[model samples]
Target chain A: MRATTIHAPGDIRLSDVPDPALSAPTDAIVKVVAGAICGSDLWPYRGAKAITSGATVGHECVGVVEEIGGEVRDFRPGDFVIVPFVHCDNTCAHCRAGVQSACVNAGHTRSGQGEYAVVTQADGSLVKTRGVPHADLVPSLLTLTDVMATGWHAAVSAGVRPGSTAVVVGDGAVGLCAVIAAARMGAEKVVVLSRHEPRQQLARAFGATHVVADRGDAAISAVEEITDGIGADAVLECVGTAEALTTARRAARPGAIVGYVGAGHGVEMPVRPMFEKNVGLVGGMAPVRRYLPDLLDLVLEGAIDPGRVFDLTLPLDKVAEGYRAMHERRAIKVLLQP
Target chain B: MRATTIHAPGDIRLSDVPDPALSAPTDAIVKVVAGAICGSDLWPYRGAKAITSGATVGHECVGVVEEIGGEVRDFRPGDFVIVPFVHCDNTCAHCRAGVQSACVNAGHTRSGQGEYAVVTQADGSLVKTRGVPHADLVPSLLTLTDVMATGWHAAVSAGVRPGSTAVVVGDGAVGLCAVIAAARMGAEKVVVLSRHEPRQQLARAFGATHVVADRGDAAISAVEEITDGIGADAVLECVGTAEALTTARRAARPGAIVGYVGAGHGVEMPVRPMFEKNVGLVGGMAPVRRYLPDLLDLVLEGAIDPGRVFDLTLPLDKVAEGYRAMHERRAIKVLLQP
Candidate 1:
């Protein structure tokens, strides 16, 4: 099987690896159909976060169950399924509480950009579609495994409600997905902060009512101006950088919530200012497994086209190019066909 | 007029000062009927927070309107009112959004421990009772101006709901009141972290179902034992120290919120651990003005008696003694009669 691996900073390769097999009764073998690069994957590619040499990379995919362990009740071979970034035993207390990402018995998927992947907690983690749908729906279905659901989690964590003025502080795929989430949640206005022209246009098409191409103080000022100098009713922090988080906090109105979904890098939580402003911070890893069911329905019904975020696509052998495209900002997201 | 002033750390004194006068058209002069020393006041008393020598202190009081500025409405001479620590024009965006503490045009009341105090935004900050009630209700009414409302704010921010297992992380007046708030909000089990015997009894009386006396890691373990290792559904971080905040977060179940109200003293926000656990942090200065009406009715109707937090009483002339009692932990709180 060909799988993506990172040898070092700025070095991504598609290496031959042993074929995946069900290691436990709770596991399932998934033949990857479509996998997408995520913003978080860039951490290792850019050396912002360390990785062991030749570590299995990527964690987003839509695939067909090639085989399943005896204990797997809900899924079987030949079924089309979405594999969340993290696999969790859905019966755990955290999972029952809709925080599946924090499930006690959790395992992470790390070889989505491969010919085949072994997923643990198969019965609890995989969400099967009605059938292996048309090829055109594959990309959107793939996003539900991570980015789209993550965006929705941000909206839910921020308490985005009808008539809310929502501010999304990032323009990555997740941020763009968050714009759709906020809009779908009935936010009266969705304000997106993006400096790039392409992402800004996509954000607008995805339901951003206003786009502020400013950074730092100017960005906050722009959000204030759009919100009657009161800041936003709900803020989505999709970029985990300190500056992005700071902007997210400053963009929230008093009593408003900032739902953060980005994996933090060199980020320090601003406690004093948040305390003084009575602003609340919520959200961490999106409970993608928890949201998978609803989001799958939305995607299948054509309610959202989150797949548009995939600006580039390639064969699994070109996984290195995919990583480069995302790391260099040449592509919003790159979809890999196995 | 006699006012309490802090000459230095541990140096509290009753000093003669010019009578408070209406400084703005929205101001109203109040003759103090009851004032209580707060945990926050002890900050300057112990010198944790810098204070100007001889600066007037105290910000919790129930009083009678002595005089009103020409523009003052909803309050008049002879009316008994609860003066929130922070005054705000309720018409502002923040105020209207129920975050009066962050009102754009906000003012702090800093002379509650005085014979008379001037309150700004009279119409918005002063919640007038039907009439001056008997002395029995004075103490509880005074709490509505600060602690009681603050406790409620913590519970509200933490999203305390029916059937929730709530953990209150402090033994102070606000924390005890938070226990009451959690119970009132219908939490099935109210867990209070208090080592003091006196406070533990009071917490139980206020509706705490469990008391964890351990500190640091042990305290967190005890809470886990109580909640079957799942942690509380809601946590009230009423003590603003770093250790207390850490305990609050550790005692919370994944997806639970930690509503903090204690004035932070050298506290650093724990962003990484919080992110990993999906634990949320929210709350700040309580919006007493916004919660005053509902809480006032509860007091007047005998539904709650938050005044019980004041374990000691002192004459106005002995303001120094009140501060000492609170500072030395001889009293959970002290009520001053002017």
Candidate 2:
């Protein structure tokens, strides 16, 4: 099957790779129906993250179960399911505590970035839909696999509630979805930091009450100004840079929770400031599996339209262009028909 | 008036400094009754944090209102009060949210280490006791000024609830107090990680259900073993270091909160493991004032005996010896009487 593979820095290609097959009794084959490029993918695509040549890419998808091992009892062939970025047994101590991203049995789950990918612990890793989803809803349902669920994780972790004011930093797909999630969760005023015109417009459509076209100190000043200098009741940090983290914390009221869901590297909390502010730094990898059930319901009921995050969609063969579009900020998130 | 002064590295002296008087309308003179050495004070003593030779030292104390500023309305002469380590206006955004340690109007609080020190923002920084605490309870009340309150901050920040299992790292006075605090807050099993025999005994006395005399990986293993490998529900990180932070997170169940109170100078979260664990890191300079009222009540009701933390007591002239005892590990905490 032809799948997205990275041959070198800035070189993503649709290469013919060996088809996936069930190697373990608990594994199942998922025929990728729809998938999306992730912000994290840009790490290696832009040469920021060292990637071995010929490595299969992608971690978000929705697909039909093509085959299942005997041990997989909950899902069967032709069943539509959401494949979360991180797979889990759903029974580990971590999973039971609603943090399946850290499941003890997570390492065994194979990545689901290609055609006919093998999913481990199929019963726990795949969330089967009640029925086949409509074609128009597939893109939105696919986000439950990672990005949309991640935004929900950010909002919930920050304790966003009705009547609360929130500020979301970053204008990527996840950040944009965070504005939607915060609004869905009932935040009265959702402020977003977006420098792009399209993102700002989408943010407003996603229920953003204010859009600050600034970054760093200026962005913080704008947020503070909007918040009457008291900062927001909740702050969502979708960007992982030090400056973004600082602004997020700076944009939060004392005792507010600043939820961050970026794959941050080499980031350190400025001890004195965060400590003195008494802010709670809560959030990491989204326990997407934990929130998949609720988020899927929201999409099915048309309560949220996360598919809008897919500003650009293309066939799986044009995966390289999809990566470039996202790299150049020409797309908030790219959807692919595999 | 005599006070402890750090002249240079390892150069602590009992220097005669001019007496403190109200310089601001919001300041009041506190007649120092008792003060204690802090783990953070060792930073400058070891030359890690340079100190000016003639600078007054110490931030913890309980004292009498020897003189009140014209604007002071909370107390009058002869009134006893608990002076928190950091002074605040108690009305700023941070202070209003119970983070007085980060108060915007906190530039005036003079350290209460000297015989007579000027307490800034007296109405907001001083927590007056209902009455003069008995002599036997003064030591316990003094801990409320910082250490004990700091421990309470750790437990509260970690969301310690009834039936929760908590692990406290570090055997310092603050850690011991955290054990007491966890138990006081109704943690079903409070575990203290300590290597010393006396400290272990103190931990148990302070209501620790178990004591693990190990550090680092071994300490985590012991904590996990005690919890049937499930890890504790909450972790109190009284020790501020990368190793301690890592162990605390490792010893916690996924989705658990780890509260830290040490003055962390240059610590950064080892991003990946922490992010993967999905743990929440909450803590900082304890909003000591926020918990002072409740802690003092517990001490007055004979519900907690924090005075036991001060194993050594000396006259003001022997302040240097007090610092020496704490630096040499001869005492968990040293109380200096003025």
User: Largest TM-score belongs to which candidate?
Assistant: 1
Q: Looking at candidate 1, what is the lDDT of residue B100?
A: 96
Q: Candidate 1's interface RMSD, please? A: 1.6
TM-score of chain A, predicted model 2, versus the true chain A, to 2 decimals = 0.97
DockQ of 1: 0.66
User: How high is each candidate's TM-score?
Assistant: 0.98, 0.96
For A194-276, candidate 2 gives per-residue lDDT tens digits of 88999999999999999999888888888789878888899998988788888898988877889989877777776556776
For all candidates, state DockQ relative to the true structure: 0.66, 0.63
- Candidate 1 structure quality by residue, lDDT tens digits, B206-292: 999999899998998898898999999999999888888889989999999999998775677757677788999989889998889
Model 2: clashing residue pairs?
Answer: none
Give me the TM-scores for chain A across all models, comma-separated: 0.98, 0.97
Instruction: Assess candidate 2 and give its TM-score to the true structure.
Output: 0.96
Query: Fraction of the real A/B interface contacts present in each candidate?
Result: 0.60, 0.69
Which ten contiguous residues of candidate 2 chain A have the minimum total lDDT?
Answer: A107-116
Q: Cα deviation of B319 in candidate 2 (Å)?
A: 0.6
lDDT of 2 by residue, B91-201 (tens): 887888787887887843345567877788889888888778789998998888888998988898888989989999999999999998999999999999999888999
Worst 10 residues of 1 chain A by lDDT: A263-272
